[model samples]
Target chain A: MDRYAPPGAGSAAGAERPQAEVRVPEIPGLPAGIPDGGDAPARHEGGEGDAAAPEAELTPPSAGDRPAQGKSPFQALTVIGQIEGHVSLPSQNKTTRYEHVLPQLIAIEQDPEVQGLIVLLNTVGGDVEAGLAIAEMIRSMSKPTVSVVLGGGHSIGVPIAVAVDRSFIVSTATMTIHPIRLSGMVIGIPQTYEYLDKMQDRVVHFVVANSRISQERYRELMFRTGELARDVGTILVGRDAVREGLIHEVGGMAQALASLRAMVRQGGRHQR
Target chain B: MLYSIIPPEVVLRPADGPAAVLWEEVEASGARRLILRRDADGRVVIERIISTEPRDYLDPALQPGQPYHPGRRE
Candidate 1:
């Protein structure tokens, strides 16, 4: 079995194919038609299965304090550790590869069984291009998407937190906004500075467009001085992020799920 | 989000050592901890985490008037 194929790991590429048929495990509370859990549904003729299906029919799939394998209405996608792009990071480092995530996002967008999505993010961030690319794919998805910044969504992670349809930040979560900095030896010429400025503009524009914050305020935060002892930027914690308009609400998993359920119930996201 | 239910009556005192109770979920796939005790009759007692403290990890919104476990839907 693939190391990543542990039960409830969510849809992962099978050991057979790199990105072959993406099979999502049955997160009990999710709606039907959602990716089947590889195993065929148990056919209980006229008793337990029938009773279970009907009871779940009236209500949306939620943890509901039920033992897992509870039906769920959406898939949970987590983005933890550094976002590893084209160049692989060291083996010891905890990384979320864009190559892996890119394929998964495509599969999720294509799968009709999967309804809405809840993206959980906790990253120190990495490659700007790869992170932005994933953010764009999520933003362009047809299904509703909600993001919750569980820990610190810093660096390139800022754009991702705002890329979804709706956003949430827990009371303890923090986000850092700073000017993009390139690593490795640089030419340090006028042209090099110009190139860097252009790239930073791309991130600035994306952040402003997707979130409630304006270009002026965002830039102010990005270039703010005297905040970090070694770096320049502003750190917005929890409600601060919401007040700044970067996140839609100051909430944890409960509020985020409640909002998503309302969106699904409103028919914007058709549930089976 | 896997929880090993240990009843309150069971005397379990953080076996092995103190663990930082953050982001650590006892996955069904064997990421877990066990609490065990040998009784006078040589019977071993096991206490599992039926519910976790700072239950915020389970559902950030699970609050007020609701029991930790769901009502029997059946």
Candidate 2:
């Protein structure tokens, strides 16, 4: 009876009580000596509670949990659908409101833990002012930034794609370079044409200033005829965009992230 | 003025009628403010989460287009 008592329970009182040997259900993959919950002594030392502690330490918290600690240092901002400006488009039309993006950009810039930013663009573009405003924000951000043109980055998206520290375009992506034009009823006055030309100049200057494309070549792409069936513009695909000096490289996500990480490391060294 | 590759005719097309969608802002758990709207199937769907905390954006449950049930704690 004394020999039957557990090593921890080594008293006459322990020997008097019935030592019911409890057995844990054998699970296939689990080790043989898993203690049953009803067994107090074994549970206290190496039971469910003790088992869970090491597992919690081994596995990181999921994204749904407190992700701030476990999240990646770099943040990704996707600019897809239409770049919605002042007016909200119909619900059917997918739009990326500037109001939403602007605030998020501010937050990203302010987050000290965030090391860098990667802007993924697949926009058909929208209002010139709104696009330029977004472009300016990305350009002015002190943190290392990179933009990747995935599907298409046409018209106003061109400026935004080039606004980053380095830009990459997937091999199949296409970018349309065309002059800005009024959508609704336009009063056919000389002033209206001048206003349109001035707006176009703004986009041209922004692209030329931030990219390797010369002003003349960009303008040629904008005003070139016989390219689009209806409109006058040049459709640059992948390497053509890199060759035109608009996008920095013609690679996908891998190149973009690698370049951004390198830039972030370099920036961190500089700050240190 | 718009500068897009999409045609002006398609881009500026007028809506058939005013949207009848109902949007409501509700206070969710963890001090999160969520803008919700009912979908076609009558499930309350998340339109957006309005919070200054950047960490809120990382929450998968609070992402846009996800269904939101009131009084349910995840």
Candidate 3:
């Protein structure tokens, strides 16, 4: 019987998890990892008890009882859907090719508990309209917003980075600036040019309005040649993008957080 | 306390356990840092944190019948 006892039993290892479970402080919303029972351990004060409660409680029934195995509750809006992925657009049976972050974005915006949003991007730039739509939603968010470019934030992502209250691009992250593209089409007249012009104007205007850069510089980057394919766009490195004012800073997580915190602080002040 | 900035490498994975939030590694400023954290607002905070310690474990591979991690100390 003694050999059957777990090696870690009866030690600090035994004391750890129960301690967290018992320690749910009186916060309005439950913490991320703690279990559901109000009368668990509540051992620690404001420690992990507060953070762990929600994850333990909110986990779906289908998830089963491996308390240690639940997905962290979006205690803070954890990424629910894939960025630039799909979520059943009303019109299309197929998922949108680009990042259609609307569902989660809407949830975050509607969530009063969600005081801010952070968008992480590493897209190769798919479906322009879809990307732009996501960007617009992020732009209009009442809560503070920040975007961090991971591997890439190309094509439609140009608008996304600027849409946030602030944006960050890691030194290795690459951002491509290109003109609006189209799929197979039939129009070959002056009307085609008009369509292109309007589309181009939309991208330019959105990027310019959201970012600190002027339209002229944005155009220069977009129209620059020898950077992309026969009709693609220019690619900017982290520092170059910042120098061009398309991005606010040539930073990573720290800068992104600082920006978010500032925005949250600012937003808090306004509410008060 | 709030941080003005957090590096992208300080991200804590679910496997590493939970803290005030969960985090993941991201590229930026030429260092391996955290790219995300759950903030007080219930949002995935992309800011950096001051500590890189493995605070809590959100291990997904724990026993099914178990309702909690073995001795999960906050």
Candidate 4:
């Protein structure tokens, strides 16, 4: 080891992976090399707790693919489709399950070779709990993380997009921020309304805390009635997203990757 | 230090005229396309960003059941 080597360099080997494993992982169409078997060790927290079922029982063979397994110093996570939580969505509907994401995050957190994370989101937004849980996991990661919004990151996707250390969006990508919605049976109860308000509070607080937007201002956008036809909330375009302070910049993938690399370089100095 | 962008490399145009071009290593996030086209004044100026799409990954031996697809190039 060099006399001035970084702090974690020596210890990184403990978590080393095959060199062919590039760390840019975010729910690939199919994840290879995962030890999917009846004897697969007990899945840690966020495993969705259904390891006993046969592989066919899982939603799509790709849902739990381990694309994140690589020896590189960076990892990419894609928060696409609707985020599925306690209940799995239909197989046909695109989804980012919390179960799959949770373990990957843990690996990224523990892996020494992995230094940073990139979150790519193109979700219409799915279950609130699942989305929020993913966002919280990402925001709490010790390694620096950045998010890029391609296409539309609507509804709860708003929280995930803003959760990163830095954010980027293409000139044409847009994000929609509407009040939360519920699809199932509705009892006209006071507690139900209160629960809704609290849920809204969680999303609003997270977005405001991570980004430059103000609390009242965010709510104002959330409740705005005219921007979206037949829906409330404001629609922010590429530059508009930057102006509103939800995302850090109005740039594309290169900018986001550059930012992540820069953060990792800084981390190299500090040796975090 | 790692964040430093890859420098652009100069490539001469394949025409009989006295023209040259500069190209950047573009990424899928779309921030690429900083082509340095020389203007009439013999000075280079930013022309336009050509494309900003994610590149595809293909493998001939990849089987259908395997997790084989052209993923993000960057």
Candidate 5:
């Protein structure tokens, strides 16, 4: 049993092997492909039979621990703390997603080595509460932050774009600015209607506060006639969004990294 | 339910796009609050209303309407 004991606190394998296999626990809502808990593989003295042991079986495999399998030149930023996700509410994939990001963002804010944060947006926007919570955390962080809009950053992703110190979007990136939407059972009444208005106000206030744009301008875009196939919002291109004050710039990886570097530099000066 | 007792309507919009509505009117306890979102194709959503007042208002995230805030209890 001692031989199979994990190498470190979280890992099941020891840290002796130059190249090892790692396993991560299953995240509750994420797909099977996304890693769950963090586990690593270690070299064992025994042969075939040891592989069948329960400890080895229980620990899943991790991509990080895999030996150099003739992969392309690697480029990755070490995860300083954690990447939080909240699957409490379902999104497009019918699972509550993005709720966990807030907690992760908070943890990152407190980490000293984090230097900066980068948000990769590809969500269609799930629970507004969860999305806004994560966005607020990102906006409040003293560390420099940057967001890259890829695929789609509709609805909730709008806040995500503004939360960072700087943001970037690929030429093909698309973002939708629409009215706040609600889900669950709804009973129509005057009081209910009133509640809806106030809620919209809150969203507008937050977006205006964090971004370079104004509330009036945002409303105009949200209420656009027909940008979406069947929706009542405008889908702005990278350059168009930047021109409208919704996004800061329109470029790919190079531009994003440059903005991040600038933000990081600014943060360093603030600390001094 | 009674509201903030404001003498006038404080109509404010955040951006120039279609306004996203929030359901539920709770107390504005802190600067940190959650924003809700719906997956593409208008499916699955959740909104938590938090305000620094008695009895929060639970409104739908979509469907255009008026703002719900803390006010006098009826």
Candidate 6:
């Protein structure tokens, strides 16, 4: 009879029982062996599959392996939608809260690894004080900074666009220069107009100090009539802003990043 | 005072309904606080990581919209 025959088939069944009992543990050991051996091949198949899709493979695994591995020296801060101030705007309105941005700016400034900042402004503009507060913070930072205005940087966005060391406006971008006006409650006293005028002056002064635009010309643009259908303001688009001396150049992301990099290189040399 | 071209009436309009999702701050491992909310599937998802350290922002697990597994260590 074959030694490996089934337990019930052979005359030696009783004698083979001890051998079969010893082999029973090997049945469970097969599954354990698959995990040890199968895991490597499964991983190899996965690695091969990942190699087929290079772009997808690159970001996720690298991001997972080392989150801070490819940290860029330059950080971008996007100021979009409306700038929300002290009072929280209704949830419906898309607003950039100053509280969130202010701390990030501080963190960017304090981080030694961060070499420069790029402010991307695409705002319709909101709260006067909040906008000015953010603009002032950007202006005060010692590190090299650049601003790029894409789409529209209207109203209070003007000061922020100019607050950086250099500014660029995409060819299709537009900026509206307008006098500040109160919307909600007005006391109707002469003091109300005086108070608003003073607020306007703060914006005007900040822009004039930061950019090449003169106060007289800026006021001219602010109070210009017949341009806006209902309001008295001048809309400066692309090269018009540069020609008027409100923006440094008529360009987009490439120019903005290039200028910022050059500025950072120069700043590094000076520090050394 | 607002300086935008958008009208005040449009800017200050009230939302139609109560907010659907509310984010609550939860303390996680490594002294990190995460703003999180449960999704439609009832899975806890991170909304934002509030940490003073800039390096904390780079953590892939702590990214916004990432699933927050309660017992996972940093």
Best by DockQ: 6
lDDT per residue, candidate 6, A1-272, as tens digits? 00111222222222323342222111111122221122211100000111111111111112234333533588777788888766555545666667667877887788777888888889999889999999999988988988999999999999999999889999999999988886667567999989989999999999999888999999999999999998899999999999999999998889988988898867741111
lDDT of 2 by residue, A1-272 (tens): 00111212333222332333222222121122111211111110111111111111112213344333533567777777777665544344566656656766786787787777888899898878889999999888888888899999999999999999989999999999998876566668999888888999999999999999999999999989999997889999999999999998999889988988898877741111
Candidate 3 global TM-score = 0.53
| DockQ of model 4 vs. true complex | 0.02
Estimate the TM-score of every prediction: 0.58, 0.71, 0.53, 0.61, 0.53, 0.72
The lDDT leader among the candidates is 6
Write one digit per residue (lDDT tens) for candidate 1, span A18-105.
Answer: 2321322222322232222222322101011111111222133344544443323576667776676654332223455565466556
- Tens-digit per-residue lDDT, A29-70, candidate 3: 223333332222211121244454232232223344334322
Model 5 TM-score relative to the real fold: 0.53
**Which of the predicted structures, 1 or 5, would earn the higher TM-score when compared with the native?**
1
**What local lDDT does model 4 show for residue A207?**
92
lDDT of 2 at A5: 16
Give the runs in model 6 whose Cα sits over 4 Å from its true position. A1-70, A184-187, A268-272, B24-35, B47-65, B69-74
CA lDDT of A270 in candidate 6? 18
Tens-place lDDT per residue, model 4, B19-72, is 122211111122212222223332323232222112211221121122221232
Between candidates 1 and 4, name the one with more favorable DockQ: 1
- Decoy 2 TM-score against native: 0.71
Candidate 4 — which residues are off by over 4 angstroms?
A: A1-70, A183-187, A268-272, B1-74
Candidate 6 collision pairs: none
lDDT of 4 by residue, A60-124 (tens): 33333333333556667777766655543322334566655776787778877778888888877
Off by over 4 Å in 2: A1-71, A183-187, A268-272, B17-35, B39-43, B47-60, B63-74
How accurate locally, in lDDT, is each candidate?
A: 0.55, 0.67, 0.49, 0.56, 0.45, 0.68
Backbone clash tally for model 1?
19
Cα lDDT for residue A26, candidate 6: 14
True contacts kept of each: 0.00, 0.17, 0.02, 0.00, 0.00, 0.22
